[model samples]
Target chain A: AQSVTQPDARVTVSEGASLQLRCKYSYSGTPYLFWYVQYPRQGLQLLLKYYSGDPVVQGVNGFEAEFSKSNSSFHLRKASVHWSDSAVYFCVLSAQGTGSKLSFGKGAKLTVSP
Target chain B: GPKVLQIPSHQIIDMGQMVTLNCDPVSNHLYFYWYKQILGQQMEFLVNFYNGKVMEKSKLFKDQFSVERPDGSYFTLKIQPTALEDSAVYFCASSPWDWGDTQYFGPGTRLLVL
Candidate 1:
């Protein structure tokens, strides 16, 4: 069974500061990785995705994630976050031959303090 | 950008009752999925359906649970004889195709079974 681990439960960063959310997955083979963000009282939105190709993938709102096969990780990074970036970010994994069912991590709540 | 809409933002029912959650997936999407998320917990996959058939289901999808897309109108998850443990947010998602495709999620229906 593939599972995602997001060690950070909550993070508080000042506006305009750089941010990184660490994500690690337990899977023998490479799987589809994704980052989704959910604002209060809203549906989840895709931030970015990584499958095969270059390790780095760009997403909406200055968000990006790098797939590290050797590290078994795909960490989301933002050069500079705005107040609007405050939300619950989820790290998701979708393994092959599993009907594309997503396995989500306990989302990390990010607070961009002014 | 695509959107998946879920009917009934919130639902409250007594144990042993029946509840149906409706999801209007993206028009061109072919795969529909249901996920359960408890308060402060990670989202867990419940089931996935395509071609009017269930492709996969997790253990959380108990025997009391069922899914169907009648006439290709709305994808529905029906829980008969709901238990207190069923109190959680149910999210509906859809993807144009399976494997590596972005899944658009609905706002989720908060179900509370007393």
Candidate 2:
């Protein structure tokens, strides 16, 4: 059973502050990892994805994530968060040969206070 | 930029009523998927369709739930005789291919079954 775990259910940060959202996954093999952001009343937008090669992947809006094989984790980070960055972030896992069925984590709601 | 679109942003229906959620996937996408997310919960994979057949379905996909993409038209998820537990935001996604391809998601359809 492939699954993703987002430890932080909610996070509050001041504008211009750095942000890090933790995500861990349980999968027997190397899985495709993705970070998706859902804005209020909007569809999910892919932030980034990691399948292999580079551990650190860049995403839209200056967001990035590092895939740690040893930790079984893919953590999203931003050097500075703007108010527009306030959204729900989801860590998703998709195993190979499974038709790309995604397993999502309980999203972390980010609130960037100005 | 390619994007997916969903019809009926929100729907309120009584239990035992039937509901059909429509998804207009990307123009060239070949794989379509459905996911369900209950309030404050992680999104769960419902089913994946390719080549006019279901490729995979998670355990959460009940017997009453069905998916089809008739005539290369909108990918649809139909739930017959819905139950209270069936209430959730249903998301539609599509990918060009299956091997770690990026899946573009549509704005979810929020379903409330009373």
Candidate 3:
């Protein structure tokens, strides 16, 4: 079965510091990966996605993710963090040809402090 | 910009009572999905709907759970005889095309069963 794993449950970083949220997926075949962010009491918002080409994909709020097929990893990164960027980040995966059902990681809680 | 909306941001119900969570997908979206996230847990896929039928459902989608997109209006998730374990945040999302497309999620409906 396809699964997603987010190694960190909580990560604290200073404002204006660089950020990286780790994600790894387990799948039998080609995988479609996505990164989503959730604020308190808000819905999940898409940050970035990796389907086929370009190992690096850019997303909203100055976020980007690099997809590595060999390592089955799609790690999210931000050049600088803001206090407003503190939120829960989820890594999601879907099989190449399946429907819209996604298997999501347990999420990493990011705290950007001043 | 298109968005999804979920009705009844929060609800408290007695165990064994039936509850219906409502969602309105984007106007031009062709695929709809439901996901559940228990407090402090990752969001998990419940089901996906398209073309007036269910395209996929995860094992967590019990028999008591049903989804409908009647008249192309609200997409609803009805849980019959809700259990205590049913307490979670249910999110509705829609994609303009299919699974590979970026999904827009609604503010989730938090359901608590007592």
Candidate 4:
């Protein structure tokens, strides 16, 4: 069984500051990792995905995540954040043969202060 | 960009009543999925459907819960004898193919059982 762990439950960053949301997964083979963001009362939106290409994958809204097989981590990072970026972010992982079933982490709430 | 849509953005029902959540996937997508997210918790995979059959399901998919894509028009999840525990956001997602392509999600249906 595959599982994901998001270490931080909540993170606060000021506008224009760099931000990082940590994510780690436990899977037997190469994992398909994804980052999703959810504004309040809205559905989850795909931020970025990491498969078997470059270690660093860029996503919408200037977000990016780097996959590290050695660390079993795919952490999302942003050079700067805005108040509009405040939302709940989730780290997800899927195994090679799982089809469309993604194992998601207990999301991290990001609060961007103006 | 392709988008999925859900009906009855919010539904409130009695504890013992039945509830059906509907989803309309992208026009050409072949795989459909259902996921649940309780308040302040991680999103959990429920079931995955393809070619008129369920491809995979998680432990969270109880016998009381069922999924169908009748007529290939809408993918639906039905919960019978709904309990308070079943009150959560039910999300429907679809992907073009099964190989880890981006799965677009609908603006989930929030169910409240009282």
What's the lDDT for residue A113 in model 4?
Answer: 94
lDDT of 4 by residue, B1-114 (tens): 678999989999999999999999998999999999898888898999999999998888998899999988889999998999999999999998886788888989999999
For candidate 1, the per-residue lDDT at A7 reads: 100
Look at candidate 2 and tell me the lDDT of residue A79.
99
Task: Name model 2 segments beyond 4 Å from true.
Answer: none
Per model, kept true contacts as a fraction are: 0.85, 0.83, 0.87, 0.79
Off by over 4 Å in 4: none
Candidate 1, what DockQ? 0.88
lDDT of 3 by residue, A1-114 (tens): 899999999999999999999999999898889999989978888898888899999999999999998898999999999999999999999787787778899999999999
lDDT tens digits, residue span A53-73, model 1? 999999998999999999999
- Give the DockQ ranking, best first: 1, 2, 3, 4
DockQ of each: 0.88, 0.83, 0.81, 0.77
Q: Is candidate 3 or candidate 4 better by DockQ?
A: 3
Top-scoring candidate (TM-score)? 1
Global lDDT of each model? 0.95, 0.93, 0.92, 0.92
Model 4 misses residue B4 by how many Å? 1.2
Considering chain A alone, report the TM-score of candidate 2 relative to the true chain A: 0.98
Docking class of 1: high
True contacts kept of 1: 0.85
Pairs that collide, model 3: none
